[model samples]
Target chain A: MVAKRIIPCLDVDAGRVVKGIQFQHLKDAGDPVQQARRYRDEGADELVFLDITASVEKRKTLVEMVQKVARTLDIPFTVGGGIRTLDDARAILSSGADKISVNTAAVQRPEFIAELADMFGTQCVVLAIDAKRRLGRGNRRAETGERAANVESDIAREASPTGDPEVWFEVYTYGGRRPTGRDALAWAAEAERLGAGELLVTSIDRDGTETGYDVDLLAALAARVNLPIIASGGCGRPEHIYEAFVRGRADAALAASIFHFHRYPIPVVKRFLRQRGIEVRP
Target chain B: MMTRILILDYGVGNLFSLMSAIQREGAEPLIRQEIPPDPCFDGLILPGVGHFTPVSERLRRMRSAIDEVIERGTPILGVCLGMQVLFDRSEEGPGQGLGLIPGAVVRLPDSVKIPHMGWNRLHLVRSNPLLHGVPQGAWVYFVHSFYPQPEDESVVLARAEHGVSFPAVVGRDRIFGTQFHPEKSGEAGSLMLKNFLRLCRG
Candidate 1:
């Protein structure tokens, strides 16, 4: 049997690592190459580097940073953000990245997914989705009170209304600012049908919270999709990883804040998982 | 005479980078689309890229040359697409391979991703002279869609994972195969090539 994966995510902007609370107020973390080496040494199963600002800036990719990290670390790393064309994907792979994660670009051109899989193979392309519960009726009063009417209308246009305002999650793109008004589960299934090798599902509400993974959402998505699900968001404790694998049935779990702050070393996390009867590579 | 390594080229591999790495290690490497029928080199290196179906077809066209070299007991190393061609057949395309090794190449499941690209750590399953000094948990670079599923597991030297490990490295006497590219794998990859040269010298 294959062991579950423990991954560390690094958000890169202008060739630097940055972490933010719920994708807002970004702050520098460190040099990407250095952070990548640290995660590898600490026993991270794989690493994910997102050029968080590439799309908005309209660039190809952070080639130099990716090359530097690839040279420094021996673990598998996936590069995401601003991968718009076959040429962009090829350039990243040639620069030494093992995999390329496509989100907005793939959604914009579904044929690009098949082209990537056909050219580089399916395993090399990962589809990342940022999901949040839709606003419900119960939350309408609080939402209106919190924001001006114009802003509230904008939010309403972007987010769907769940029967109960308190219980909805909306799909967001452009670094979780633009709402796509699509259900997370439906989008995930469509991505798989379009030949996505893996799905990196993230919860906007729980991101950077460090409370725990959105287990209910993860389980529901995992149940519906046949592709491997990478549960992201709010992985604060060691036990949270095991819970994601055993309970949520996620093939891998990705965390940023706890790992970036050195709250838990990867080897220690793997040891804990192993002791709990989960097969983890030592 | 110095040992000369011939890198069989089918115009499909990233040979420029591979050839540079070989030269960096102080080894003589000759890139040829057609191996000389007389088997002139001390050892042979089969380097490949792209899909297996086309690569295998090219090998079939050069069958006589490949057979002559293999029969001479000269050590051979196959990398990535080169390694897949050693199997009995491949589901990658129309089917049929060199049959140098017993196995079949199949598509990786959608659950694990098709091209298991990246730097993945290897788990050594058995000992082989070709892998001398290579640590059990050493990491190597990989970029491929179809993997070798050797019918005989005994030849498997190292295994790595995407969903489940097939075989990262395999060896049987003088012939060897690596699903990962040693030439592009940095120091560890260079060391592996050196080890193969040493095997040829012995």
Candidate 2:
């Protein structure tokens, strides 16, 4: 049986590991190779390094950083963020990354995803979806402070919406700053249809909060998709990870803030999960 | 001096991890892009990644050098694409293999996913000294669209199942081949490499 995975995410910028609040206000963490070695020793099932600044002119820095980390770490590591082409994916994989995660690039050109899967195998291509709850007409004012429209024609349109509110999770690109208005669940299903072997779902609202995972959101999405779901965002403690496995039905839980701050070591978390009867690779 | 293992690099696969793994097992791995005229190594590792056609062509181009090393009875291990090249021929591309083993490499049946990637348990078949002490049913990492089908079943050391059970590990005396990558298979994989190194001692 396949054990559940515990992944530590490293957000890299300009060849150094960094973390931010809601993908902004970055702060230095430490050298990526050192951090990766620490996590591997602490029993991390896998590592995810997102070149958050790969989109900028300082892109070569990511390849160098990944090569450094790969040289030191023995476990599997995934590199993502700004992987726009097959050449970029090949470069990262050649640099020793076991898998490559794509977000913006995959959404813009869906065929690129399949082509990658064909070249590097489906298990190596992880599709990450950043999503947020779209404000409905009734809750529009609550979120955006827009005055309620009172026109008779506007009222009629609001009364009969196109779909269920449960299906209204909107897809966001550019690290959840741009809304695609596409249904998140629908997009996830389509991603699997397009040969994505795994799905990394990140909640825009709960990211970096360290409060807890959005269990309801993850559960709903996990229930709809058949592929392995890697729940991301708001993992503050060991119990939160347990909740993700049991309640959210996530096959793996990914954390950045708590792990980066040293609040929870991966070995301790894996031991706790194993004690609680959760099957994890030690 | 510690026994040195030579990793034959034909410009196809990643050799960094393979070199690291060999080092981790307490052996010195010398990565060579082209087979050297005077091979100075205890064992040889032919590592290849990607499509079979180009890899076969590249191996044939260096035929004299490769044959020289093999003729010396250097314990050789072929991984994935390299393993496919050890067979007589491959249906994947229009190139003949080195014919180190009597088999034909062909694409896996369409019933299973094209690239069978992920961890699968190995079922040991013929007990060989190369697999000495390695536990039965150990999970090893695999990533390939094609697998070698040996004409002689006795050479198959282990088998694994995806849609159907196929040869996962094969060997004929000093020449060993694995469809899965031991360098990337974690602790169990490292153990397998250690066992292969022990064969070099003899």
Candidate 1 lDDT by residue in tens digits, A117-218? 767656677889888876552343342222234334544442333334356554567777766555566667667777677888888878888888887778
In the range B1-202, model 2's lDDT, one tens digit per residue, is 8979998876644567778778878999998888778767889888856567777888889888777777887788998887889998988779888898998988776665445655667889989977787788876777676788999999999998877788999999899999888886766677879988988765
Superposed Cα deviation of residue B186, candidate 2 (Å): 3.3
Clashes of each: 13, 0
Sorted into a CAPRI-style docking class, model 2 comes out as incorrect
Please give each candidate's TM-score. Answer: 0.76, 0.77
lDDT of 1 at B33: 82
lDDT of each candidate versus the true structure = 0.76, 0.78
TM-score of 2: 0.77
> What's the CA error at residue A43 for candidate 1, in Å?
1.2
Off by over 4 Å in 2: A25-27, A54-57, A118-123, A135-166, A185-197, A211-228, A246-249, B1-4, B23-42, B52-69, B84-129, B132-168
**What CA root-mean-square deviation does each model show from the true structure?**
6.7, 6.3
